[model samples]
Target: MQLTVAPIPFFWSKDTWSAFYEEIAETSVDRVVLGELVCSKRLPFFQDQIPGAIERLIAAGKDVALTSLALITLKRERKLTADLVEMGLEVEINDLSVLSYLPKGTNFSVGPLVNVYNEGTLRWLASLGATRICLPPELPLASVEILAKEAEALGVTIEVWGHGRLPLAISGRCYHARLHGRTKDNCQFACEDDPDGLDVATLDGQPFLTMNGVQTLSDSYATTVHQIDQLRAAGVTALRLSPQSQGFADLCHQYRALVEGQCSSEAVLNAITGQTPEIRFSDGFLTGDRGVAMSTPPIAART
Candidate 1:
């Protein structure tokens, strides 16, 4: 199965952003959907680096695609969506409204943020020139199998969210700004301080979620270490791994090994846990269990 690196959902400096893509060009990933996917306000800081990064990745034989903002509101954001088509590379549509801006018969891809939950939605998007789609992370494997089967018939590549924190929701109100007693406009880019996102806790101090500007994400990383065989069996074409700040290149290598059958699921999970023991891993979203539940033995949920 192919591995895809999803766009960074956090606010990162231009230097760190450029360096991450430079490192990605050397990884085992086949395709990368890179652009601002969460907040459009963060785009200006690193927008200039996109062209160079795309050139480098293409030279390295990696398929690169630009991503649309997950939630487009302002007039400038709409203009940005329209301009994505002007770029020669493929556009990965995160918001459905982006379709209204694309020219007829323009080939594009769909990001997981779009609600492609059923076969009808899948077929409709394919008809509108979506060549590939990364299914939402909350989908169960049963739904994934059904959609993958339909996608195969429609000649669309199906990708599953293989790794990273699950993006739960996006809001117009900025949680980070609210936390600091500031409004969204005058927050002064507070989200940049926590590159990976600020963790939130319950009333009792139990970890609950992560806040990144207006986006809310899961506390644990959603991993597919145990579902590689199952996803491949179901005709899933690729696995999309989201960007993280630390040890990301090594994380790609580990997932690559798992995809190539060079390592067992337990071994891969063990290696990941060894590297970041404090971080929890979950496959429950795909296994029909609680979204935060982690499978013991790593392969126990294969059925």
Candidate 2:
């Protein structure tokens, strides 16, 4: 199975972002999807570094792709989408609106943010020159199996969200700014303070969600420690691991070990938990009631 590193969903400094990719280039990951996929306002901070990052990842023998912004509204954002084709890399379409602007006959991949829930959608994207797709993180294994089969028949490659915070929703409002009593336009870059996203909790103080500028993600990292085999059995060609601020390159190594059968699922899960014992891990979206579900053991889930 191929291991892919997803673009950084949180806002990090250019130095940090550059260093992260520099480290990843030395890892065992097969592909790296870099560039902005969240707020376009954050683009200018690190956009100039992208070209060099792409060149480095490519030189390291990795297939690299550029990701489109999840929600595009501004005219400038529209132009940005229209220009991804010229990047000369696979443009991973995160928003459906990008489809209208994609250069004619350009081979593209679908990001998990776009709703690719069923065979109809899968086949439709395939028909439109989608050579690869990362299934939405919320999909169950049954849906994954069906889509994987469709991808196989259509000669498209299938990928799944393997690890990192689950991106729940994107809104026009900037929650991080609103939390500090500001609006989206004049928020003063509040999100940059929280590189991994500001953690939100329930009334009773339970860690619940993470608030990026406009995107909401799960507080617990969404992991698929046990689902690797199932996904491979279902024809998933790669696993997209979203980038985090710290301990990320190590994560790439751990995942590569798991993918290559060098470690057990429980061992990998235990090791991950050992690294950050406080945060919870979930594969419920692929195995149980909801995204937070984590009752069944790895062996049990296999059955």
Candidate 3:
């Protein structure tokens, strides 16, 4: 399997976002989906930089796609969605409303935030000219296997959410803004302080989730080190890796090595933990268990 970098979910400065994509252009990732996916307000800070980033990525032989806002509600937002088609790049629809805006017969993609829980939904999306789809992180392995088969028969490629904090939900209410005693309009970009998202915890202070403006995410980074073989065996074509605050380029190569059999699971786990020792890792969503659960083969764990 190969890698497709998901759009940046957290709020970051223009320089940081630009530099991150510049570095990504040189990585082994096969494709990238980039844009303001969470909040439209955050777009102006870095929207101008997108063309340059996309140009560089394409110049380096990477397939690039623009993403629709995960929650498009307002009139201006609708205009933005409608305008995405005019950019002349593949558009990955996170919200179903985008389907209305895409020109007929345009071959687009679908992001994980959209629900594709069954073969019927997958088939419907395939009928709508969707060429690629990154399945939601919460899908079980059985579902993935079934969907992969359906995608192959329908001439569509299926990608899995291979790594990164699980994006649990997106809301019209900004949790960051509410936490700081403000409304969505008055959020003042509170999410900017947490580049990787602010950690949310239980009353006893156990890490539970993360809040990135309107998006709720898992505190643990989800990795597929132990499940890659099974996924490949099931005919999965690609793995989507979400962008993090740091060590992502190195993380990309490590995943590539793991897929190519050049590195052991132990080496990958070690490399990942060594880079960001504090972040938790999980793989349970694919295992038919609670989303946060983690397990490994004895050989993989001991290696």
Candidate 4:
């Protein structure tokens, strides 16, 4: 399976963002999804860096795509979506509002945040020039298999959220700002404090979710090392790995090794444990009761 690096979800300084993409351009990853997908306000911070990053990635022989905002609710945001088409790169639609602005016959990609659950919706998007789709991380294996088959018949490539924390929801309110006792409009950027995301534990102090600006993600990282065979059998073409603060390029190499049968899933988990011992890993969305359950039995036992 091809590895695709998804856009950074947290707010980072302009130089840090530029440096990350520069490092990514040299990685073994096949594709890179750039641009802001969370709060639109954060876009302007690194807006000038995107064109250069895209150019560098393309020069390095990596397919690059721009991502739309996950939640577009303002007039300025609508105008920004319209302008994305002029950039001459494939656009990954995280919000449906972008569909209204895309030129007719323009083939685009769909991000995991879009609710594409059933065959009807899948077919409808395929007809609307959706060339590829990254299925939502919450979907089960059965649904992924079905969609993969249907996507194949429709001449569309199917991708899955293969790694990183599961992005559960997006809100108009910024939790980062709230945590600092400020409203979304007047607050300074609080997300920069946690490059990955601020952990939100439950009342009993169990890590349940992470707050990254307007996005809510699972406390546990969602991994698919144990399900690589199942995903390949389902006809999945690509695996989307979200960016984290540390050891991200190594994470890419690990997943690539697993995909190429060079290493075992247990070995990969062990390697990841060394880098992020506090992280809780989960694959439950692919085979368990809920998205939070880590259900690869053999790997779990090895851990």
Candidate 5:
């Protein structure tokens, strides 16, 4: 299976964003998805830099696609969606509203956030010009297997979320602002403080989820290193690795090694040991269990 690097879900400075993509341009990943998918307000910060990044990745022989916002509400956001097609890049629709903006017969991609739950939705999207689709991370193995088969029959590529904190939900209210006791409108970009995302703990102080502006994610990163064989057998075309704060390029290389059969899943997990002691990994969504359950064997003993 090919490796695809998803767009950064966190808020970062313009220089940091540029540097991240510059480094990614040289990674072993075959595809890259860029553009804002979380908050429409943050678009202006890095809007101008997108063209340069896309050009660099494309020049480096990587297939690149742009993403639409997960939630499209405002007039400005609607206009942004309409303008995305003008960039001449494949647009990954995170929201269905983007469908209205895409020109007829223009091929697009479907992000995981879109509710493509069954064969019907998958076929409909394929008919609507979706060349590729990243299934929602919450899907079970049986669903993935069924959809993969259907996708292949329809001549569409199917992808799965392979790594990174699971995006659990998206809300109209900004969690970053709520965390700082401010409203979404007057929050003044509180998300900038946490480059990755602010951790939200349970009442017992256990890390439960991550709060990123208006997006909510699981604390544990969802990985599929151990399930590569099954996914490949099911005809999955690619594995998407979401961007994180640490060892991202190394993560891509390790996944590449795993896909190439040069390294085992245990070895890939071992490579990430020192990066974060608090790191937790899960693959249960694909295994048909709870989203946060770690179906794979633990790499290091947790305290």
Candidate 6:
């Protein structure tokens, strides 16, 4: 299976962001999707750097695509979506409103944020020139298998959420700004402090969701190591790995090793925990359980 790195979801400084893609360029990843997938206000800081990053990734032999923002509300956001076409790289449509901006018959990819739940939705997107689709992380194995079959018939590549925190939802309001007691517009990029995301906790002190700028994410890092064989058998062609701030290039190598049967899932899990020992993991969404539930006991328990 091919490994694809998803766009960075957190707001990182321009230097950190540029360095992350530079690291990605030297990895075993087959494709890399770049560009801001979150708030529009943060784009100006790193907008000029995208062309350079794209050139470097291409020079390193990686297929690259740009991502549309997950939520588009304002006229400026709409203009940002429209300008993605001018970049000449494939646009991974995270928001459906992006469709209004693309010309008819323009080939694009759909990001996991879009609700592509059934065969009908899959078929419709294919009809609209969608060449690739990363299925929503919450889909069960059965639904993925069914959709994979349909996608095969339509000649569209089907991908699954492979690794990273589950992006549960996106909002018009910035949670980071609100947490700092400021309005979204007036907020001074508070999310830049947490490169991964700010972890949320329940009233009783249990770990809960995570808050990025306007996105709510699952507390667990969802890994497909346990389900890779099943996904491959079901015709899934690629795994979309989300960018994390620490040891991500190593994470990409571990995933490549696992996909190639050079390592065990437990080994991969150990490598992950070795980097960030406090991290929790889950694959329950693939089995049709509560998304936070883990299907297996922790192979490498957190310290």
Best by TM-score: 3
lDDT of 3 by residue, 1-303 (tens): 879999999999999999999999999899999999999999999999999999999999999999999998999999998889789999999999999988889899999999999999999999989999999999999999999999999988989998999999999999999999999999999999999999999999999999999999999999888888889888898999999987999999999998988988778888988998998989989994789999875464454
* Positional deviation of residue 183's Cα in model 3 after best superposition, in angstroms: 0.6
Name the Cα RMSD for model 4. Answer: 1.6
Q: Where does model 6 exceed 4 Å of error? A: 297-303
Superposed by TM-score, candidate 3 places the C-alpha of residue 22 at a distance from the truth, in angstroms, of 0.7
TM-score of each: 0.97, 0.97, 0.98, 0.97, 0.97, 0.97
Stretches of model 3 off by over 4 angstroms after superposition: 298-303
Instruction: Identify the runs in model 5 with alpha carbons over 4 angstroms from their true place.
Output: 297-303
lDDT of 2 by residue, 86-138 (tens): 76788999999988987777789999999999999999999889999999999
Error of 5 at 180 (Å): 1.5
Each prediction's whole-model lDDT (CA): 0.91, 0.90, 0.92, 0.92, 0.91, 0.92
How does residue 38 of candidate 4 score in lDDT?
Answer: 94
Clashing pairs in 5: none
Residue pairs clashing, model 1: none
Q: Taking the tens digit of each residue's C-alpha lDDT, what string does model 5 give over 189-224? A: 999988889988999999989999999999998999
lDDT of 2 at 242: 89
- Worst window of 10 by summed lDDT in candidate 1: 294-303
lDDT of 5 at 206: 94
